[model samples]
Target: MPISYTDQQIREKAASLGLIQEGADLPRQLRGKVVAAMAYGDAAERHQAPEPQLAGEIVIHGSSILIDGEHFPWLVAAQPMDIGLNPDGVSTVRLTLMAASVQVIRPEPRPESEH
Candidate 1:
């Protein structure tokens, strides 16, 4: 099975592929706003090889987006999910970016009995 890549690895690969340039961050137009991108594949393709779910939250500021949820302020953020490789070997994903600050807050703990 192909190994999954770390956030850093993915970032580097993206840069190498020219999807992103060195030291370039998410577009400023996407800052503080949420946008979504989606891709679709045929059912037969899924039967041949299943894909893993890729979803996460991120923060974006200026020209940078944090990979994982970290304490890095002033960085732009974009979350890409439902990643898949097309027949042409082109990887696709549904990406969303926040136009402004995006806060990912943990759900509040409820009473044990509530579970």
Candidate 2:
């Protein structure tokens, strides 16, 4: 069975992953940030091969994340579910999206001048 997490738990998890501030708006914080996404394959092909990394700016429309003009459903109501670390030792979180379980790498912060 899939584990269900509360909103507070989600927030805490995101914060711990450095994906959000203690009380910041998740969608707002992630909007326009550049990210690299890896969409996990189906159960049958999951362990067979890895998906290519897609890099693009985050665009939140309703409950979806738009990257390179493609719309990816965002699960957890625009919040990313903490999925722990990857084999490369990089921290990761599952967007819990549609059939595609997207793992978004930490977004690079823009320069102070851009803020």
Candidate 3:
């Protein structure tokens, strides 16, 4: 069973991610502003690289969003929720978007003293 949260809950979560401004309308602002989209010069070539797909059990439990078996607390989600199927014929749920975001993760910043 999935959990549900109120709009206030979602608002708070989005705020922590810096996805919304101090006084922005949470509902209206989230329409297309928070998601990351890819623009490719050639649509065909883009698809050849890797396509996004949705193949996981997405549910809201309490304040967490559970995708596949991963427990992502609070409405933390990358819009354009990309996905891909596992080559294996297993029914295991997998969050492909989470995996793909690896390229964007930056190393922890060093202290000012170290710089």
Among all windows of ten consecutive residues in candidate 1, which has the lowest summed lDDT? 32-41
TM-score of each model, in listed order: 0.20, 0.24, 0.24
**lDDT of candidate model 3 versus the reference:** 0.52
Question: For each candidate, C-alpha RMSD in Å?
Answer: 24.8, 22.2, 19.1
RMSD, model 2, all Cα superposed? 22.2
Evaluation by lDDT, superior candidate among 1 and 2: 2
- Compose the digit string of candidate 3's lDDT tens values, residues 3-80: 345566556656766777665567765733333211122344556746666646666454466767788644444454
Better of 1 and 3 by lDDT: 3
Looking at model 3, the pairs that clash are 3-60, 3-61, 53-83
Local distance difference test, candidate 1: 0.48
What C-alpha root-mean-square deviation, in Å, does candidate 3 show against the real structure? 19.1
lDDT of 1 by residue, 1-115 (tens): 4334444544554466566677666454532221211111233455674566443544444445453566544422444455575566545544554456558889899999999
Candidate 1: list runs displaced more than 4 Å: 26-115
What is the per-residue lDDT of model 2 for residues 78-114, given as tens digits with 9 covering 90 to 100?
A: 4555556545655444564443465779979999999
Supply the TM-score for candidate 3: 0.24
